[model samples]
Structures are given as C-alpha cells and as structure tokens.
Target: MMELAHGNEVYTWPGEAFPLGASVKQNGVNFSLYSKDATRVTLHLFASADAASPQHSFELNPSIHKRGHYWFIFVGNIGHGQVYGFQVDGPWLPEKGLRFDKDKVLIDPYSQAICFGRNYSRERAIGPGRNMDASMKSIVVDQSDFDWQDVMAPRHSLNDTVIYEMHVGGFTKHPSSGVDKGKRGTFAGIIDKIPYLKEMGVTAVELMPVQQFDVNDAPQGRQNYWGYSPINFFAVHAGYSVENDPLAAINEFKTLVRELHRADIEVILDVVFNHTAEGDENGPTFCFKGLQNGAYYITDKETGNYANYSGCGNTCNANHSVLRRMIIDALHFWVTEMHVDGFRFDLASVLARDSNGHPMKEPPLLWTIDTDPILCSTKIIAEAWDAAGLYQVGSFIGDRWNEWNGKYRDDIRAFWRGDSGTVSRFASRVLGSPDI
Candidate 1:
C-alpha cells in the first residue's frame, strides 16, 4: 500500500476503482476519478470548507495508483465529512478538445455532497491560474448513517397522478409561506408544507432541479434562480439545506423524501441530464470539462466547439459509454438510496442524440434506464424535445417511458383563447389527445 504523511499523521492504502466516487469504508475513504486522456492526477485534502489552501496533496504515480483511466487512493485516517478535490495535468489543446488545467481544483463527478467555500469564485474558475481556494470542494459522506425509518414511496400511477410542479426554494422562501424562520426555503420547509399539499389532493410533487447546480451560472449581475444548470447529479443543492454542514443536504433531503412518502405523496425530480453548468469553451471547468472534456460533452470534430443542442451552451454526450454509465448510476443512486418515486427529464430528447449530434433510432442511455432493474418500477417521464427542435413526443424511444404531451398543452391553450380552427383540435385534446 502507498503511504503519505501529513504533519504527524500517516495515511495509507491502495484504493479500489470500481465505485467511481468517494466511498466511506471501515479502513478509510476511497476516492476514484476518471480521466481518459489525463497524464497526471493530484488529490487535494482540505482542513475545512473555506480553507485557503489544501492541508495535504498527493500526486498519484500512474504506475501504482492508476488502473486504466481511473486514479484511485484510500486514506487510512479520513472517513466521513472529508473535503477534497482533484487537479489533473494534460494537454491544454482546445482545438483537439482536451481541456486539462492542472491549476484548477476539480470536484469528483460522482460527489455525493459538495462544499462551496466562502472564497469560492465562479469567475476565478473561468480564466486560468490556480482555483484551489476559490473552487468548490467535494465532501466525503457516509451514506449508511441516515435512518430512512423504512418509509416507502407511494408510487401513484400516471392515470391517477395529480402532479404539482414546484421549486423547493421558492415554495417557502417568502415570509408569507408561514414556514418557521430558520427553516424557510429549505428541504425542512417542504416538510412543513406537506399538510397543505395533502389538502390540495396532490398525489405527487415534481420538484424543479434539486441537484447541486451553479447559482452563479447566469448573465452578468444576475443569478441562476432556477435550479436547471446542474453541477453534480449525485449531490443535493446545499442552498436548500438549513445548515452549512457538508452532510446536512444529503440527510435533510432524505428526510424530506421520507416525510413526503409517509403522507402518501410521491417526489419526482425534474432532472437535467441534457447539459451541465460548464457552458461552452469559454466557460468554467468544475468537474466534467476539467477531467475529460471530449468524453463528457459532444463537441465538433474539426473545430472542437461544443454542440449547443441543450441551448444552455453545451450538450452532454449521453450516448458516450462513460456518460451513459454515469447517468445510469446517478438514477440508481436516487431511487435506491434517496427513495425518489420518479424523474422528469428536462430536455430529455437530447439524450436521444448520437455521439455525432444526430438523432439516433435507439439511444443506449434511454434503453438502459428503461431496462434497469432498479428503475423498472420507478416512474420515468421525458420532455420529448430538445432546444435544437428534435421533437419526439409520439416517437420517443422506450416502451415504458411516458412523455410530457406538449401538443395537448398547446392545443388546449389555443382552444381557450378561441383561436381559428381550434374546435376540432380542442375536442381531441380533452379526450386525452387521441389525434396525437
């Protein structure tokens, strides 16, 4: 086993590379990251969330620590709540689509929880230079620590489901929400409003993107109010948690899900697997772009420019082998661990595109999610369209996947407005859009 000393403490172990994230074990915490083209990988350990510098940094020797494209290490002393990040060294050739900045501290792609330090600066990550102090760090979490209370999801059928779409923060952030002072705009606040939802006869709550997203990913002087621009899929957004503790969001979100299930209300996450917060080539490198830019995102072969199918700057290469696996793993984690009832994929048609950005007849990622045993019983809803106008409402792949009928919404609105030739279309829409 490899050994590293930090002050008087010595940490040692050769970590496993199977589980892609930081996993807590009896020995210590095992960290594994994937970088197909990276030459060197350095792991940085921080003393605290806002620490100006790393307490210790280890440069993994590829001969020993690397197994294929994965770099892994097990620290003997550290377990839960450990803050860490990575710095990968490789070719910085944007023309060839390889953006690897050794100076920037990149979070784990499979981070269960993230720590945004006081010095965290999205601007600093945009340009060059070291972003260790200014970058967000990933925290090690013991997933087994929480007691789910054996609460199960009340999976309501689509025919009987009355879904209420709401944003977690905006639902109770205002004073008029009547939520407790400290608990307002948090997962705990959602629990307090459960009784109101039950009264409304709402069977399910389709929450806007609750995954950890980049709030700074908006225009200049503006913030990303909506939680659509996600950073990490596995971690819950920390802003919606009551405490600043790194692990608070995880446990609190679990509690919210458990409580909602107890009230016989299902939780459906509006997931954004189409794109990431890391925008185009000029955007910041948080995780995916820094690790393997070419693999994570679909880019132009000649110019190396990102495919803007997501209309949010860059489109995720969901059909790629690595990304397909990561997406499936994320879904599995939410269903098995978080106990969520369903997922509403935002711009899901983007997942239908091939590696070259053309629509595929049968995308591998969608099929995997459809056939996965863990997600077989879980509800799956697709937006059935992308920003680039690849509409597949009636033709969306997967027999089990239900699509959001955009035609029904449009025709119903037109009929209500008393538009021309609306009577015939309106009749079909009210009858469940049989004409569609």
Candidate 2:
C-alpha cells in the first residue's frame, strides 16, 4: 500500500500487460514495460518532477508482475501527474549487445509525457552510476482529459496539397513574428499564425519532428534545435509547449491541431523513426538502450556494434517485431488521439531494411503502416532514402506511400540556373517526371 498527497492509502495490484506504457484507470494508474532479458525491475515514483530521489520504490516480482516479456504493476491512489521511471537489471555484456544499466533511471518507451527536471543532465546518463537525480522521468497522463471540441481533419488530397515544410520554433521565434513574447517559438505560436498559413494557400504543414527529443544531443555548447533526435516517440516535445508542465505539451499540440483543422489546413509531422537521440554505443542511455538494446536497434552480429544505416550514429531495427508494433502504435495514437492528418517519414528507407541492415523485398513495418486501418485516410510520405545510401525513390514499397521526388527538385533547380541541355528534363519534371 502507498500513501498519497491527499493522505489516502492505496494498494498495489498485479497489472495486466496487454496495453503497454502507463495507463490511467478509474482506481489508479497501471504501468507496463517490455524488457525481454531483464532479471529484475524496480518502479520508482517521484514526489515531484525535480525530486532528487523516489518517494517510494517497488521492486516488481517476476512471479506476479511479469507476463511474458512485460512487467507491470498497478498502484492505487496515484492518478495523473505522477512522475515515475524504471530501473531494469540484466546482463551488461556490450560485446554481445546487452547494455543494461540498473543504475540509470530509464524513461518509458511509450511515455505520453516526459518531465525533464531542473537537475536533468544528458551527460549524467552516459557511463553512469545512479542518475535518478539527473534523469528525465515519465508522467502518468490521462489522455482523455482534453476536450478537442469536435474538430475534424481537413484530409486534403495530394493533388491539391501545397506543403509548407516548417520548423515549429523557427516559424514564430523571430522578434517580428508578432506572436506574444510568452507564446513565441511554441505550439501556441503556431496557433497564432493560422491566418498567415491560410493566406498563403498552404494545404498542409509538415512539422519537422514535434516528438520529444533531447535538446542536449548536439555538440558541446550547441543545442539540438532541429528536433530529429527523438527521445520518446509517443510524447510531444515539451520544449515546444508554452507551459512548463509536461502535460501541457500534449494538450497544447492537440489545440494546435484542432485550430489548424478549423482553418481547413492539415497537420503533417516529419517523423524520425529511423534513429533516436540515444546515439551510438558511447551515447546516453535515455530509454531504448536502457530497456532492451538489441531488440530496439540493429546491431552488427559479429562486433555487436550499432549499424549506422540512418547515418545518425545508429539505426532503429524497424522490422523487429517489437519495434514494428511500436511504430504502428505511435502512428495510431497520433491519428486517433492527436487528430494528425498525416506523416512525412524522415530517412524512411531505413524502415525497409532487415535485421542485419539488408534491404528486404517486403519490409513488415512499412507494410503495416501502409495497411493500418486507423491510418487508411492519413497521408503517408517517405523521404525514400537513408544516409547510408539505401535509395528507394522510384521503387519505395507499399501502394499508398508517396515518395519525395529528389530528381524533380534537382532537375528544376538546374533548369532555372541556366544549365545547358536541361530543357528536356525540366519539361519532364513539369509533366510530373514520368522519366524517373
């Protein structure tokens, strides 16, 4: 049993493993995580976001709390705004591709919200001891709390779409953007610019990685402003929210989508499922590396080193059964809960690779995304290449998937630059590039 801030005692129950991540129930919140090789798992509950240590910790017994590869527990009396994380103990054999650090307080892979405390440091998560004081924690969120106000997606067709690829912060961060000082460079700032987007005839706005990412993933003094270095797939980037609260990112992003939908414009996210912020082996153990490294990433069989298919230090094992499910689930959540109109996959060719980083004839993850019932109406665009030279531009898998035309872009640029013998190619590009 546990005591709450309200002075009520609540008991712990053996939670179900079907629905993953933290789920808020009527009685309490149920937490579930997948760690196939973990020998021991402990749940740490924080009193607040910046709490140096856990107010309470429960070591999950494999006999009762574990089902298959999932470990779950339900703590009554605790509901929304509960800050928590996991510490999984297993074999730490990096040569064989198991990098488990029980000392590190790992965030949930399916976290709906992440709370980066005042003491949170990315450096502390590397080559670590106990990083509870410097770690980012996950929050138990009640996803149903928000009122979307019956806003429906515009669902614009590709033929009629004029996409404006934009960075959320850069869109309104400038002093002359006219957005309020407090709301600048945030989801609220985007909401304030709906009129301008409508005036420009932009049918869809492809937002560049709004998913929660590590700002400290960049070099010594520089921060990662592009947001391609994702930390959590399900959570919206809290840094994009005007409010400091973790849940504010979720609701504020929803409000941005709702308001954009009202203005007859669609919201498309530039999703990076190819790689994560937890870079190569020497990088930080944020979430995936701490949970089950081999399962989440594509590692070299002989050396046990990370495979850099995405040229971003590591490549996600997208075709792995566990990761395949996660990618689909994230897409479903965005479509159903967040009301997103589409996804523009970054370095999408990486998703077409097999376990050993070989391009598959038919990758399961791409097929799953192509046929996902919830995403049947959602627009799906692929960059059609990886940084490691795996190009699938003209032959990208799946019937519904759209590929970004690099040939057309280059040809058009050459023609306008007065390059000789570029007329035929330019004419072909004008007629939708049939030659490609």
Candidate 3:
C-alpha cells in the first residue's frame, strides 16, 4: 500500500471506475495502464471524437490507486465511445528497460476501436465502449447476446472439410470480385457472398482475424498487413462490420452462420492468442498490459521487463488466469454464441509457455482447451511453432488438435516451384496427419 505522507484527496472524482469496460454491475469505469516506472498517469476524456481537444481531463488522486496499480474513479457522466487516452509520466530510462514517454498518448488496452495516429493529431476517435447508447453502464453493449434460434455448432468432419482461408478484405477488395459496391469486404459483404462460397465447394471458411484490431497501424498502407495482431478479442472489427452498429453486425454474422448451417458450411477463425497488437514498450497500450502489467505479462522478475515470445514483441503470459480467461471466453463466445466452427491458433506453442517463460511439459492452457466439454467437437489447428523458435509441429501433437503441418507449406512451395522429390513428401502429407 502506498501511504502518502499526508492524507489529502488529490483530485475530485466525477464518478467511480468500472472494471474491463463499462459494465452493468459497474457504478463507474476503471481506468488502468501499465508503467513500472511511471510517476503519474492521467485519464483524458474527450467530449467529442476529438482527442487533441479533450472536453475535460483530470489526474486521479494518488490515494485511490489500488495495490495492483489501478485507478478507480466513478465516471458515471461519460457515455460509451467516449474517446480517451492516457498520459503516463515517468523515467525515460531505456537501458534499465523502461520507456515512459508522457508525450506519447497511450491507448486504453481495452479500447474496442483503436484510433489511428499519435496523440491528438486526428479528428475521428475510434474505441468501443458504447457510443450507440446513452444508457447506464448497466446498458453495456452485450458482446455476447442471447439467441434462442439454436445451439448449432459447426461439426465439420475432417475428410469432408475443404478449408478456404481468405481475408475478409482481400476477397472483396478485388474489383472483379463482383461484390456490391457498398458492402465490399465487410462482414455483411461476406454474408452477402455466402452463396458464392458454397458454390466454390468450401465447407469451412477460415477467416484471417475478424477480432477488433488496429488496421490504422497500416493506415499509410505500410501494413500490419496480416491481421495477426489482435486488439480486442471480444469485439469484432468495426471496419468489417456491415454497419456502424457493431452489435447489429454481430447479429448479422450470426444470421450468416445460421444460413450457412442450412447449406452445411462452417466458419473457422484464425486467432492470435500468442501475442497481441501491442508490439512492445514501443507499441501502444491497448488491453491486458494496461489492466495489469506484471500479472498479464511474463516480466523479467529481476528486471521487470516484458518477455517477447510471440514475435509481436509482448508475449502474453497466456498462462495467467485472467488473460487466459479472456482468451477462452472469446473463443467460447465465438463458438457457442456466434456458431463458429473452430479456431486455428497462431503460434500455438507460446500457449505452452509458463508465466516465467519456461515451456511446461503439460501446459494447463493447452490441456484445458483440448478437453473442454463445450469445445470437444471444436476443431483445433495450431500454427505449431512460435517466433521464439519453439518448434512443435509433430513434436507437440495433443488429442483432438491438428498442427498446421508447416512441412506441407514447405514441400508444397517446393513442388509448385518445380523442385524434385516434392511428389513423395506431398503424398505423405496428403495421406496422413502431421501427428506422427
């Protein structure tokens, strides 16, 4: 507990802070961020979508910060989609492994829509709290909604499955795609073109990543390119939604699934739980790290620096219960609620790492997923290796999971390139599982 020399209410709080995001049980929203050496942190609230011009921003009284380094203040007056940024002030000592730049406006780790650019330089603010409603925090947008239609899980058997992996954008971005000019490359666009997908003989459509992420990271067209970096696991990409109403887009996605079910098609999500969009100390703070730094990441216990296991920079200590739950709930929501077929885990081996960065012989996370009753029928495909050089293709085959068979990618590339002996290796991959 940090005991101030003097008991003084540093700043007047408008309301209480809620956990994660605005919640029904929440009387206020909790504002949190990670900075091991940060001296001060302020929550800036904008009246409009303009961050350069905050309507009113204030620093929380130091007395309110919890042991977990969280600042809880009741912020009842603010509605959802309220553009916010964090200004953290601390030592800029990099050699000591700390990069605290108060000048750089940090994003809320839990932000649903990550606005582009550094600091106030833009007019449009993007982050999901709930700009669509002025309802009480109790009126929080249910990322998970109730549907009585049916609990139709896409049990796509192995031999029958023809997985068509494609980007939600690329498929429609091509002018020749013949998609509706308005609905091009959107969730609705995909739904609109589901018939074409059926016609192509694809039983399962494995999406790159529909999870909300920072497309703006590639705003200049440089590209975070592949949607490998995930921003919010729970929220679908706002840009991909057919309409501005994200909830409606979700319902429409569900409807698309229902329709596809009638036609016997499945939706597989390419999920990146190995790491997040938050690159490193250099990248912006979007979620888990901001919620709980040391807890959510595998920090160098000695130096308190983040470990980079997923190649994305900050390796999520996926073994952590809270973060692990976030990953699990996201998948469960996709499968049980949205009726998704399965998940292809990018960098599956990282999930096998313990919080301390050691590879566990039997990682609890992998085991639980393999045996989850709700996910028993779910098809699990692993990228099988990670950027950290943990290769487990045929090495780490678990029950009920399929490794991506990277060897297939290598051999197939060789064959298409007209390399010799490719035919024999291709036969083995086609005939059997990479399991052995």
Candidate 4:
C-alpha cells in the first residue's frame, strides 16, 4: 500500500472495474480492489443504517488515483448499495516490512458482499473504547446474487487433505444433533453436516472462524467458545446463520462452499490475524483502536502501549500500514470472497513479529504472504507459535507457509492421550503429514 498509508484515503470513488464488483455508476458504484502490498489507498464511506446505527460517515483520498499493482479511485456520483471501506497509508517501520495505517477503516479483502453488524446493539463496531467488534467496520453488501444450484469446490489436494476442526456452533449444537429448531449450528447446519462430512473420509473443512467474528469476547474470559476471535475478514458469520439472513449468511455459506466444492472438498479458515475482537487497552474499543491507535496495534515502540503478541491482549500491529491493508484485505476476502482453500495463521510467529515484538528473520509479513500471486495457491497454514514465546517450529521462512506439523499436534495428542513413545510417534505423523 503506502510506505506509511494513503492511497487517497481509500477510494472515495475507485475505478478499474472491468470485471470486479459493486458497479452501479449513474451516481455511485465503481470500487475496485487489489493491493499488491499497498503504500496508499482510501475509501471508508458509510451512510446507510439508522435504527441500528451506521450513518453518514466519511473518508476519501482519491484524487483520481491508480498506482501500480492496483489501487484505483474515482468518486464521482456514488450510487447502488452504498457502504464502503478502505484506509491505507504507508510504513510504520517494523524493521522494514511496512504496515501502513491511515486511520484504520479497512475491509475489501476482495469483498463479495458484506454490509454487516452492530448498529442497534451498542458495540457499533467497537474501537472508541472497545465495542463488541467487526474490525473497523466494512459492510456494503447487496450482491449476494445466489444461484449456486450446481455448486462446486471440494478440489482437495494437500496430499488429498483430511482436516476436520469443528465448531460452527459446536458442530450441530449438541443435544444429539437432532437439528431442527434454529437449524442447530448453521450454514444449513453445515448443510446437514455434509453427509456427515462425506462419511468421515473428511477431505477438508477446517473452519474455526468464518471471518465476520467477535462472539462473546470479554478477553476470552470465555466467549466464542472457540472461534479464535477474528472480525469481518470480509464477512460471513452472522452468528453462523442457518437462515437468519445476511443474505442468508451469504447464500448459505456459498451453498456450503458449493456443496463442499462439488464433492471435491476443501475449506480451511482459522485466521485471527494474531489478536482482534479488539481485546486490549482494557480491551474493547474495537475497530483497530479507534481507527488508528498508533496504527493498528503492537505498541510500546517506547510505551505508546500494546504489544502482547497474541497473549490475546493486543499484538496485531501486523507491522501496521492500515494494518497491512487489514491483513491483505482479509486474505483477499478468503481467496476472492470466500471460495477459500487455506489459511490457518492464528499466531504465526505473531505474523513474523517486529512491531517491537522482535523476531523477524526476514518476515515482511511472512515474505508478503510468500511471494503472493494472489496468495499463490492459497494454503498458508501456521499457528506457528505465540503466547509470545516465539517458536517457529520446524522452521518458518514462508514462501507459501505450512506448519501445523506442530510436532504433529504434540505427537498426536501424545498418541491418543496414552503417551509413551506412542506407536512410533503415530507412524511418524502418518508418514510425515502426507496424512497417510
């Protein structure tokens, strides 16, 4: 984005929509996206909601822009399903990685349809003093279009993947999952547990945090039973919606990711950008600390404050720069707006630290998400290590990240909890994670 943040304050009227989205131009709707590691960009217009909150807000740094790699702007008339997001700037200096932060309002990680939460509720996108959360705020959705009928996307392959990690409301919501009533744990209750995850063969379904998060976060004193606290990484979790609608929770989670990618199967999510649900500074003012608390976290450059590094207190100054375009617009909206295939990241060596946290063997945000060509083939996976101890584990330079080999989840939970050398370390982690 910027060396410190300012792509005309993020699209008051962005352009270059040959084939992108949100395009109703008689008055307004040109918005386009692609950061190429931002240095400047801006567009955080809001003015829709009322009884629930979210009215006439402002921000626009477009001066007829369009810098390389992608950062266009064109705020002429402004029309059609309006609600906006963008706030880029440059360099906050975490070593030399560049984090930018023109006062926080980011979220277009290639947004497919957002316009979501917290108006009548009081959290109002937090950050002023910690409201519940929706990470700086970025709604504007009116493009759900829904038509997936034939569906698609199981496309499995990290060695024919198997992943399972539950909790879309506790995978079916206990009570023997009789379902019915409240569609027990939604997305059509995982589309009725997708034939029980295709009869347990698994294939792939990772989801620990369907983006638009922030449930019960009181410093994890114990809320979000296990969502890993993320927020609007390009929307999705309107309380896991079975049908409460958020465009039916983005068309039943894109028809449950097009019926598990049309039987090929592959969803991996778990994100968390190492701290959000805005928990720090006494925890809760939301929206990256009131639109720019020292530019999205990791303080103490000398006591400016916050830098817990995933202790869950603060730590997401993700090298800052409009919080790294809100972490590359929430990973390009989970791979072009929730088509998803991979991303685990959680602490990921506190995303390669440096916001004064330290360790950075060369982490320019994990090497710009490992030579990102729109995240190469996606799948980065990390949870590498953080409660601040900094453990890369089996190494982590990243060119396309991978590492939940975490000593193979502690030797298969210590060999199915029995522990003793455990059947040759669980057959060397199923022949070393090819997941044999």
Candidate 5:
C-alpha cells in the first residue's frame, strides 16, 4: 500500500516534470504543465468528457507542486481515459501582455487525446466566467497501449522520396470516393484506398494536417476545409474517428499508420506550428493563451498586441526555450510513439523569426530541431516562406531540411502561361533548380 494525502476524499501526490503531459503511471496519473508566471494552478477532474461540472477540484500548493517553471500533481486512483483540465490564476492585465483567466478551463499542451463535444463553443472561452461545459477537455491516454505487431517505419531517403500530398478528410468525404458511408472520411477509409496508392507507385503519403484542428474556424457561413487552424498538436483529429469514444481516434490513427507501413508506404504529417485556431486579440482562450500568453505568443514590443507574422492574426513564439522544447517533444511523440516517418511544416519560415518578430541568422529552434538526437535521422521539410513575405529559399540554415521549391512552381507556371522569354528559367526548374 502507498501513502497518499486525502482531502475531502481527493487523494494526491507530488509529480515530476520530466514528462510534460499527463502520464498514467503504475499507481495513478501524473499531470504536468509549464507556466512561467502563474501564481497558482488548479486541477479539475470530470466524470465524463462532456460533464457540465467537475467531479473534484484540487488547487495545487505552490510549495508542493511548483518546481521551476512547471506545476505538477499526481492524483491517486486516476488512470487512463480520465477527463481533466487546468485553471491557472494570475494577473489579467492584457495591456501588459498577461491574459490569465482562471475561469477558462485549459487543455493540456501535451495531451495525447482531446475530447470535444458537439456543443463545444469557442466563443464562451474568450471572456470571463467558467466554460467547462462549453470547452474542450483533455483525456489521459496511455501511449504504450497499442500493439504494433512488429511493424516499423519505411524510412525512405529524401532523394528517393515520391510524396503524394493530400488531405485526410477530402480523400474520401465525397460520394465519388466510392467508400462505405460509415467508413468514409476516416483513417479507416484511407486503409480502404491503400491498394490504389500502391498501384500508383507512390512511396509516401504527405497527410495534410491530421492534428486536431478547428472546423468552425472560418467565416461565419463557411467551414475550414484545409485544416490549417490547429487546436492541439498532439491529438489526432476526433472528426476522423469512427466511434464517439475517446480512444477511437488514437487507436484508429495507429491502425492507419501500422497498415500503411505493412504496404511499404511512409506517413508524413503536414504540421502547422506558426499559428493556432486561437487567432488574434479578439480570439478565444485555449490552452496556451490561458496557461501562459506571454511565453507562447509573439507580442508587439510597445503595445503588447500580437505580432502577426504568420498572417493568422498571431504568431507562435517558436524560438522561445519553453515552446521549442514543446515542439521537439511533439515531434518525438509522433516519431517514437506514433511511428510517423517525417514532417512537412506549414508556414515554416515563421519559426526562423526571433522573439521580436525579426528573422534570425541562426534561429535556435531550427538549430535545436536539426541537431536533436531523436530527430536527427527524421526528415525535416519546410515551406520556406511566411505570410509576412520573409522568404528563405536557398538560405534556410539547416543542411538536413528539404524545401517545397516555390520558385520552381512559379517558373513552370510562367513558362506554360507564355508570360515572357523564360526558356532558361524553365530549363533550370526542370533541372531541379540548381541555380537556386
């Protein structure tokens, strides 16, 4: 038997921060979060994903749970599939660049599975008041539960790569897709179409943003079809899962990857690390904004407003030490846990900027990612430009990074459109743009 502190029948213990997310240990679940300036942090536990209120709440004592920049707690009798969220308290002065609202429940930045309800409303999260019933919750999932059945990554070299970039939902959502109504537009649907991909001689499928994104993040009358507005970097999109259960997305996603690997096909996720579904100043409060706004985002030096280098109303502070570690940790999770082959960064140029929004000659985030031991063998690709017109085509620092070759597309289009005497430029593009 293990000793545990019980207050009103809520058992708790101190947790470490080596693993940042909520981890299911042998005895209980360890919850950890990074908040630099937070004075107090509270953990809320719910009976279900869509519970209207918390079943139990524990406010972590700073002396016991606080260590450095991380706040953590180990709750006894809580294991896998437990639904939880955090409420952080601090100064709410937005003009000073601090937007901490203790009432807004926040998803864990390191969550492996996210639980969203049909009635989930981002609008209710923007201002004060508790929004537990209307907000998204994080589910504690065991990362080691899946059985790979001796499957491994294809790990095809970049020189021999034949990438077929496509969207996950659009691949089979249409009636012309000829898939079963229930399996259409799901990870299982992709498994149903693997034969066609094999016949086409494609080596890898560049999945366009499988990370959990906001479907309602569009104009009032439209939907976000491309999935550029991501909400959680760690969880697979719940919309692509079959059953409404919390574990369905995680297991089905792993099944898709394992099945693809069996056919000698590689999986590359197109990740958007620049901006999130949470947009500018008027945007809703999610995980990062509520936990630590000044650390997660790039703000104006004088007015403290968001610096929109990503053209998405706000830019992520990718080079910050904390965010950089989170990026690397997310990459390791996909590569080691999910067995993903590579990553194609959307608006990757924004990652090269300094905290002040200026481009860096040697961005620490890029250098760290390039040199990280776990990611050294993984393929890293970049779009090579940002919405702010900061382009780094041939000048991108990392030697291991492959670019999308935007110039080649432009030259090819110009030559085909008969714009001018562009034979030399077109030929160079045909020759892989060595002139670049």
Candidate 6:
C-alpha cells in the first residue's frame, strides 16, 4: 500500500498488456482487463472467496496504467489464491449498445479460475444496486506450479479415432456408478473408471463441456447439467472439483488429463464458444456481457438485441477481431498448458457467421484456427451446423477439420428402420460420403 498525503493506503502499480489475465509474477500479481468504452475501472481485492466486500479497492489511473483499451494494474505482496474482481463505470445506454454498471462486480474476462459463494445469484446482477456478495470473484492462479511429469496430449489423428462422447457429471453422478461417495460425478471419478474406458477400445474421449458453466442457467427449477451454459471458457467447472478452493479445480482437471494420457486415451473437449451463460440483453451482467457487449456478442443493429443464431439467446461475435483472438488464445492455453488433445466445437457454424449474423464465404476465425501455428497439429472437429440452419458438413472452411456428419446419422437411422432408398446413402456414409 502506498501512503497518500491524506493517510489513505492504495496498493497499485502500472501493469503491462501482453499477458491479458491475472498473471502471478515474482513480486506480485499483474491484472489486465480490456474495456474499450469504460470511463473508469477499479480493481477490487478480497481476502477470501466469500468475502462480502473487498478489503482493498484501487482505481486504475488512466494516464499511468491504461494502455489503449486495456486497464491494467500490478499489486505488490499479493500472490496466488488472491480473490479479486473488477468494477467498471460507463454509460448505461442500451440504445447505443454500451451496458456498464459500476454497481455490478464483474469477473475478469481473462480469469483462469472463478469462485462464487453460497449467496451468488444471477437475479441480483440483473438490474440495480451493488452485488458484491452475490458476484463471482476471480482468483489469481500460478499455472506454472503444476507438475505434469512430462505428460503431453496423445495427439490421436481424426482418421484413427473412435470418439466416445460422454458427460463428465453424468459419468459418475448416478448412485449405482460404484465410485466413491466424495469422488462421484467428479474428475477423479473418471480417473477411477479408466479401466472401463480402456476395455471399450475407444481412442479419444469427447468430453461434454467441462468449462466452468452456469448450473442455474436452466428453467425456473431445473439446472443446466450438460455444461453447455459456459460462464468461463478457460476455467474448469467448480462443481466438478472436490475441494472448495478455486485452484483445486484446475489442478484436479490436469490430473484427469495426465491420467488419461497415461492410458493412451486422448481427451477432446466439446467446447461451447457459440454462446455464454449470459442469455441475452435481459440476462445477468456476467463477464462478457458487462465488459464489452458490443464487442463480444452479435447484436441486432436496429434493436440492439442479441442475434440468436445458436438458439442460446446470444450469439457470440466470433468473427470480430477481439473475440477471434480470444478464441485462439483460449485454445492455445488448453493445448499447451492443459495438455488437451483436441476440440469439438458446439455449433461450429456460428464461427462462420459475420457480425451481422450472416454466414461468410471465408470466415477469418475458422481459417485462422486452421492455419494457427499452435493449433496446426491440434485436431479440429466441428458439429458442422448451427441452430440457425447454417450447415457446413462438406463445405466447412478448413481441410483439417472433421465434421460430425449429420447426414450420416440420418442415413444410418433410416437403414436400421428399413426405409426405402436408404441403401445408396447408407453405402455412401460407410465410404465417407463424398456427396454429404
């Protein structure tokens, strides 16, 4: 804390921009957040995950810490496990498409791990007043501390892969799962059942979204159990973690990957980059919606409402420069840091849409992922369609990408039911369907 003339103490230093997230350095933690229209940004530090209010809050000095659209700050003496969040002040003009509320404590867009208390509520973040107690806090993590023991992605080719798609939660969620009580429905549960997966002779496990998603994203009483409603792209789901600590999820997820690789089993995540848990303009002010709604989501130019291409209410502005870079960076982290083999993009065709929600002939983001040096060897698989009827099974942009083959599924189903004229299509599907 720097002592001011008035005897108030403020802990802060000018931070850099290259590393976007909360980077744990030798001296302290460096936090950098991107906010193009925000007039003011404050860094709030808390003592614990359930801290009702921040112990210390320091406003970023624009002249010193602001670099273009980024508001960054380096705080001394704070290391890993430090709970933090951001508060941005700007115009609340919905018509012009800028929604910033200083009252809402937002999780960092680049947060590797997120922590929420019992009082966390999506309703509290919707309208007015400060939701500090109800807000999700971002934790500072030192990713370099994990010991993989020379473990790496199995790198199983798409041609030789027999993918077994499974849900992480349901894999062990049942009472008859035979997994230990505490370990049930968790990453450790998957580790326990490695023998079974090995016996099945599957090369790759296409995991349904393990990314930190909103469990409360379902209907009035139901819960989002599939993990499709993602809140943080980089974070491992806290519900899957055995421990309450925010860092435990990351470490446990790594342990799952390491153990899977030991058995020569490749891990492929069914990533949901198409839409966030934040539903629409009426949804809660989460990370992306509150940070830069216009930059992150594909908004209707006239209504300023979100374009629902993914049928998830808000379609991500995937082709935009900011989001495109973020998608690549997130993938690189999962590959280089998390040691994941590949990705199966949910609603992969959404990535093909332009800002106006129209399909592009050559989507830059798709081609960029195909040619990216970091992602070149990484298996790129696509669901090959969106909820908006943008199918790209045969016409998907990149040559490296393997499609889900929706036509193959239909044809195979038809043949099983002895449908007429299905023989030719079924044969084509068996031979990799050149006409699909």
lDDT of 5 by residue, 56-131 (tens): 8888888888899889988888888999999898987676668888888999989888887666887888876889
The runs of at least 3 residues in candidate 2 whose Cα sits more than 4 Å from the true structure, single-residue gaps closed, are: 1-7, 419-421
Ranking by lDDT: 2, 1, 5, 6, 3, 4
**Candidate 5 structure lDDT:** 0.87
Q: What is the lDDT of candidate 3?
A: 0.64
> Which residue runs does candidate 1 get wrong by more than 4 Å?
4-8, 417-421
Candidates' C-alpha lDDT: 0.90, 0.90, 0.64, 0.63, 0.87, 0.87
> Model 3: residues >4 Å from true position, as ranges?
1-19, 25-45, 53-140, 144-151, 218-221, 243-255, 286-291, 299-306, 433-435
Winner by lDDT between candidate 5 and candidate 2 = 2
lDDT string for model 4 (20-83, tens) is: 3345554445666554455565565566422123333333334445544455544545554456
Per-candidate TM vs. native?
0.97, 0.97, 0.75, 0.32, 0.95, 0.95
* Model 4 CA deviation exceeding 4 Å by range: 1-139, 150-161, 164-202, 205-232, 235-256, 259-261, 264-266, 275-298, 305-314, 317-345, 348-384, 390-405, 409-436
Q: In candidate 2, which residue pairs clash?
A: none
How many residue pairs collide in each prediction?
0, 0, 18, 67, 0, 0
Whose lDDT is higher: candidate 1's or candidate 4's? Answer: 1
What candidate 5 gets wrong by more than 4 Å, as runs, is: 1-10, 244-246, 414-422
* Candidates in order: C-alpha RMSD to true structure: 1.6, 1.9, 7.0, 18.7, 2.3, 2.3
Q: Across residues 144-254, which tens digit of lDDT does each residue of candidate 6 receive?
A: 888899866677766688889989888988878888889888888999999999999988898999888878888889888888888878888888877745689899999
Cα lDDT tens digits, model 3, 29-122, are: 4454434455777666654433344554667566665335455444544444555666666664443444555544555544444443233221
Better of 1 and 3 by lDDT: 1
